[model samples]
Target: MTAEIFATTPEGDTVEIVTLQNGPATARVMTWGATLQDFRLDGTPHSLVLGSPVFEPYRSRMRNYGAVVGRAANRIAGGRAPLNGATVQLETNEAGRTAIHGGSDGCGYVNWSLASHSETSATFTITLADGQAGYPGNLALTATYSLDDEGALTLEITGTTDAPTFCNIAHHSYWNLDGTPTLGGHTMHIDADSYLAVDEHKIPQGGPQPVAGTRFDFRQPRAITTPQDDPKLDHNFCLRLPGTEMHPACTLRAGDLQLEIDTTEPGLQVYDGSGLNSEVPGHGGVPYGPHGGVAIEPQKWPDAPNHPDYPQITLNPGETYRQVSRFHVTRI
Candidate 1:
């Protein structure tokens, strides 16, 4: 359990990587944006290491932009929120009118206060003022990360709001199990039978649809980039089952290492890292071109607040909001 002040860039900024070696598992954590730079499971490497120049093309303008996403983790259709019967407007960062992950200076960009840090764990907290990002209430959000003896990396996100508001948070990690040049060889298996289809704007269209014969089906283990559509999986899956109780969400294997992603979130957004602009740079001096890694983002459905048919994300005063997503890796 030792954290290192890794090499710095010409930006005159210091990037710290937290390392934790527990039994057969090792993790490298970065503070540039509070991201998981690398994780080796049972001697098999995962996570796309960060290089000198970090490039985020697809999400380039803001790829791995924030250490943690906030206020709302996903998109907010029309950038509107209904709190206490009052509609509040939010910042829209996308090209069109739709709001994607809060805006440029949204939660993802804010430098969170490091509440606590240790060899095997770290905790970060940030307080959101009322009307921050055009949302409803003042929010106090906290995220904690811990690695257990079983080699499971558990992320716990808890939030409390003084007023009615929608709060969602998550850890955006790009996992490449083979520790190779890319994530093409990594295989995936998702325990989902349907998904939320979206329109051109990438907004949820209707309700859940079956994945029995569709390309979105991941019930069987298959290469993450099997089809020519590597780095093209930008969709939300309607998990077969939803609950607060922990369950197997998805399993990924790279080379001889295997990872089981478990979460209590209702939906999982699979963004194949298709859009990494050259500006963000890459890890280990390698280029983060399309499909450099895969982001299995588990959380409430995107734009859940706008869809009445979808699950609601409203949290009022006195209601404790909690979410847990874990990546447990082991040797095959």
Candidate 2:
């Protein structure tokens, strides 16, 4: 592991970026948002993940580009959910109707303290005050990134709350295997046979729906072209029967580069970069726009706290919340 001062925030806080290399993969992680700034492989000098050229873009235009999002990674309908037989209204951050990514208090918006680091691993820790973002709990969160000899990058998220609260964290990395202008040619395969149906606001509507007759199906490898109705995908696919362990979720390929994603979570949200039209300069002086990358986030189902039928995402006192996601890259 190698650490350097990446940038000094406007608040006078110095942010550090740690580089971890193992085998054919190298990853750069930043303290701010515990973000994955860059990822590359041996054969390709080009970065496999989309990132801004400078640090300021991350605080403004590209806030979610490569951050660790939480305390609930997805949306909660009406910005509210029932906890312990009572409704808990959260602080709305998405158009004042839903709590998306834990609002301003999400882990992605804050800096984390580097707990430890080694040649192939690094761990970060952060504390969320009780009632912060209108959630009940003084949460202690930790995220660890590790790279194995086989070019597998694993992100393990763990949290414990003093009170009962939601804890569903996700690492949001926009991958562009070819580092091209778009991800239209990337082929994707997900192990899920069902997906959650969302409303116009991208909040969960009904329970899990079969992907057999829907465009959400990705059981077989297929090109990830954007649909005409919706700009791109942002729905959660159910991968487990609830009460299962870690398993393979999806695989993505672009040209000679491929990534296999496996996670312990039950849901995987695939977001094609249709909304990333920022003119900010990306790495290698590339101008990022729509379809520049794709984000595959693993977490508990969106709005699971409200829907009793869905997998639960509650973390009580003394109980730890844990989720692990691994990305195995290969040159094909």
Candidates in order have lDDT scores of 0.71, 0.88
Q: List, in order, the clash count of every candidate structure.
A: 25, 1
lDDT tens per residue, model 1, 1-332: 77666645455545556677666677765554455656765644334333333322313344553245666877777787665677778877776576666566555654455566787887767777887767778888877778888878888889898888887776677776666756778888998998988877788888999978777889999877665552257888877665548777899887777779898888888877667543544544455666776778878888887777887788899998898988887777
Error of 1 at 13 (Å): 9.2
Once fitted onto the true fold, the runs of candidate 2 whose alpha carbons sit more than 4 angstroms away are 226-231, 241-244
Candidate 1 backbone overlaps, count: 25
Candidate 1 deviant stretches above 4 angstroms: 3-17, 30-33, 45-62, 227-231, 242-244, 278-281
Report how far residue 3 has shifted in candidate 2, in Å: 0.6
- Estimate the overall C-alpha local distance difference test score of candidate 1: 0.71
lDDT string, candidate 2, 148-247, tens digits: 9997999999899889998889889998898779987799999998998888899888888998967788899987775663435889999954455779
**What shift in Å separates residue 115 of candidate 1 from its native position after superposition?**
1.6
Candidate 2 clashing pairs? Answer: 1-119
Per-candidate RMSD, Å: 3.3, 1.5
